[model samples]
Target: MLTPSVEALIQHLADGKFHSGKKLADTLQTSRTTVWKSVQSLQALGLEIQAVKGRGYRLTHPWERLNAEQITASIQVPEACPPPVVEVHDCLNSTNAHLLRTASLRPAASICLAEMQTAGRGRLGRNWVSPFGANIYLSLLWRFRRGESLGGLSLAVGVETVRVLRTLGLADLRLKWPNDILWQERKLGGILIEAITESQGQCVVVVGLGLNLRLPPGAADAIDQPWVDIRTILGGGSSRSDLAVPSRNRMAGDLSSRLLALLNAYGSEGLTPWLEDWRRWNCVLGRRVTVDEIGQRYEATAVNVTEEGSLVLRRDDGRRRLLAAGDVRLRVRHDA
Candidate 1:
């Protein structure tokens, strides 16, 4: 968490322009020493701050902030749908972790976001590299009754995220089942769904998403897999400074709105409404993949996904099997 003074100070430098110490202190009603300390703090958070001795301070790249008000106003929800409770944080251990712990307190629905995550997480015990203000770290919470199926909820979330990106004119987007986003066969982002099923007839679902807008310097080295960000997607091999990105605030607004709709209708609708679109964006289907389950690995061709959300595969032995809990990975046949 950043202090109010530091937060205010960053805004002054967000325009990617230099601000003199005296000017910043006057604007913040603080002292030049305080302003210098604030700039040091921002730099510690992995932000590239340039201090040109006499030119004052400037962010290497203009900062794009996540504003709760801006996001809320961009959402197009109806009276019955009432937009979700959107909360933005300067830093958090993890958005999903926070929402899961607090979902009981706010049972209706909520979306949590962070400019930076101190302990960002990914599926299967992976570490998601989250640099301050470089990517989208989001978690959305929804409550489901017992009778309403939680099956395919991850798939639903992934599909909706792909839809949102596609609507923004992002092309060649592909969704890997359970929850991985891909663009041109390189990792774009991923989803991690965590839930707590109560003894009663209720469940709390927290879906976390780490969408890469642009990674900071050296951040990509921490990633284990080949990945690409939104900058590469629409920029077409352009330089970082020259790349033009779609309004992140609008994307956040549309993403939450779509997910809320999916959650609201999922109970009654199940996977029926999302089946077609899911298939449209799916890249795993008809691919020779390895399914890892219960300490065993089986090489099979993915045949289809059942209505209940189970993966169906045809083994190399010419037998079909239904997989409920397994991690599927693409095999020899590389995609274009």
Candidate 2:
């Protein structure tokens, strides 16, 4: 957790430029010693701070902290729908957990974004790697009417994400089963959904997303699986490679708008409308794959996903299986 003073210091240094301790202290209305202490705390949070005797201090890499005003302005809400209430945090254990814990108090159509997550989570209890200013960590809270089924909600979210990325000029993006976005067999983002039913029969769901923007070398070392970030994908051709404030604000706003639109459509039409779009982005369809479910593993050829978003797998013995949940891994075929 970052104290107010530490967060202030980080904001002052967010431009990735050198700032004298005295100047920062003056701007923050604090002493130089306090600024130094805050800098030390930020370093503990995995930030690389470069301090020089005469040149002052600057972050090793560029970073633009999320701005609530910019993000809200970026989203284009329909006239009939109320705009989502957006909250930006300096740090949090997890955006989804926070929203879920406060589901009762928060209104429907709320979104939370954190610059850094101390305990980010993925599906099936996996640890999501989230480094400060290097990824997008966000959660959206939505309420569904009684008896409404959220069967293909995650897949729908993936489709919307792909749509937004494609609009931003990313090609060849694909969707993995359940809730993962991939680029050339490398993970680019993931989704996690948590839902609770209220006494009135309304279900509140928190849709969490973590998308890699630019992973620092040190942060990349912690990830066990192959991964890709937007910076690498853009190949220095786009301004997003710099991770500037304006670029981040634009990307965040674009994503939020697309996701909100998708949720609105899903509420009205369910997943049926998104089934064809999901197939367009499906990467594993017709590919040999391995699925691990409840401590058991099975190898099969990936077929198509059902309209309800369940994966269909065809085994060697001509058995077709429907898997509602599991961890899927693309298999390398020796024969190929």
Question: Candidate 2: lDDT over CA atoms?
Answer: 0.84
Query: On residues 1-336, what C-alpha lDDT tens digit does candidate 1 reach at each position?
Result: 889988998889988889988889998999999999999999888888899887799997777899999997777664456458889998899999999888768755588999999889988767999989888998988888877766787888888898898877788888887778998878899888888876675888888889998776677888888899987778776565334677678788988888888888887788877878888888878888876776777688887888767778889889998876444444424641
Kindly report which residue stretches of model 2 are placed more than 4 angstroms away from their true locations once superposed.
22-32, 236-240, 243-246, 326-336
Q: Write the per-residue lDDT of candidate 2 for residues 1-336, one digit (tens) a residue.
A: 678999888888888899999999999999999999999988877788999998889997677778999899889986556668999987899999999999999888799999899899998788998887768998999888877768789999998888888877788999988898999889999999899998888999899999988787788898988898887887654655565222667778888887788777777788888889899888778888877666777788888888777888899899998878545444424343
> Highest lDDT among the candidates is held by which one?
2
- Alpha-carbon local distance difference test for all models: 0.82, 0.84
lDDT of 1 at 138: 87
TM-score per candidate, chains pooled? 0.91, 0.90
